[model samples]
Target: MMTSKIIEYANNLIKLTDEEAEQLSNAFKEVNIKKRQFIVQPNFTAKNRYYVLKGTLMAYVVTDEGHNHTITFAIDDWWITDYNSYIFQQPATMFIVALEDTIVLQIDHEKEHDLKKSNHKFETFFRIMAERGLASHQRRIISNLTQSAEERYENYASKYPQIVQRVPQYALASYLGMTTEFLSRIRNKRVAKKS
Candidate 1:
């Protein structure tokens, strides 16, 4: 079942032959994460990259001032990892925590490297995923730089209504670079205008 999900995700990007599908499936292992569980934490190597099959997760870093600054979130069908740590096998500087009980398919660094080396299709698929992730981050950076706080909130709410609905207000607020009280005020204003 998990294999099918991973295969389906891959198939959406690039067609996979029976053998390739089997190989890809073999490369990943399933992990179950409880809500609030940490999958990647500071000082440990991020050995695996996770594909969310069932729930929500947030990647964040705790500042010296004891504030958590969200880096990204991954819900169903999304991917999350400390990319620098996973790619370089270095100690992590971020934490990846499940916001809900989650199931994921994870590929470790060595297996992923082997798979990419063994198959061009696998390599292409990974490259495509990486490129898309980079593009999304680029767009997010540009949006943050150019958009006002209220504009950013509006655009995020419009584009990811589901995420807004599912994520905790505090987490979402941090992700938007605003205080929870500020986010609440913005939301209240929006509701008042709508009414």
Candidate 2:
């Protein structure tokens, strides 16, 4: 039942034969995490990629200065992993924590490799997912480099209203590369403009 959501997600991207669907379903196992629980932490190998079934998760890193920099957030139908660690089979530099009580379907690195080897469709599906993730990261990098803080905040809020509404203000501020107080001021300005 947890796998059903993943099957539907895959099917939306590429037509899956009945057998491929069954294979994919079997490859992923369900996991439940409590709020604030960490699914991946620094120095541990990130062996699985998770597909969110419900609730929210955030991936972030703590700097030497003790600042937490949010890398990304995942909600229902989204995938979350430290791709660098997962793909390279190296220890993770990030922490992936559940922002809310969460359920996810996860595929281990070995199992995913086996699935891709077993079918071209599986390989294609993963490749497409990777490409899209890469594009999103590149876009974020460009935006951070070129946009003003207010422009960045406005663009991200407009594009991902759900994330803006669901995530804690501090976490969202970190993700947008702004301080929490600055974000609060920006938000107040927006509210005043609307009023």
lDDT digits (tens) for residues 5-31 of candidate 2: 888999988899888899999999999
lDDT of 2 at 180: 98
**What CA RMSD would you report for each candidate?**
0.8, 0.7
For lDDT, the strongest prediction is 2
lDDT of 1 at 115: 97
- How well does candidate 2 score on lDDT at residue 76? 88
- For model 2, what is the error of residue 101's alpha carbon versus the real structure, in angstroms, after optimal superposition? 0.6
Instruction: Report every candidate's CA lDDT.
Output: 0.95, 0.96
Off by over 4 Å in 2: none
Candidate 2, 147: how far from true, in Å?
0.8
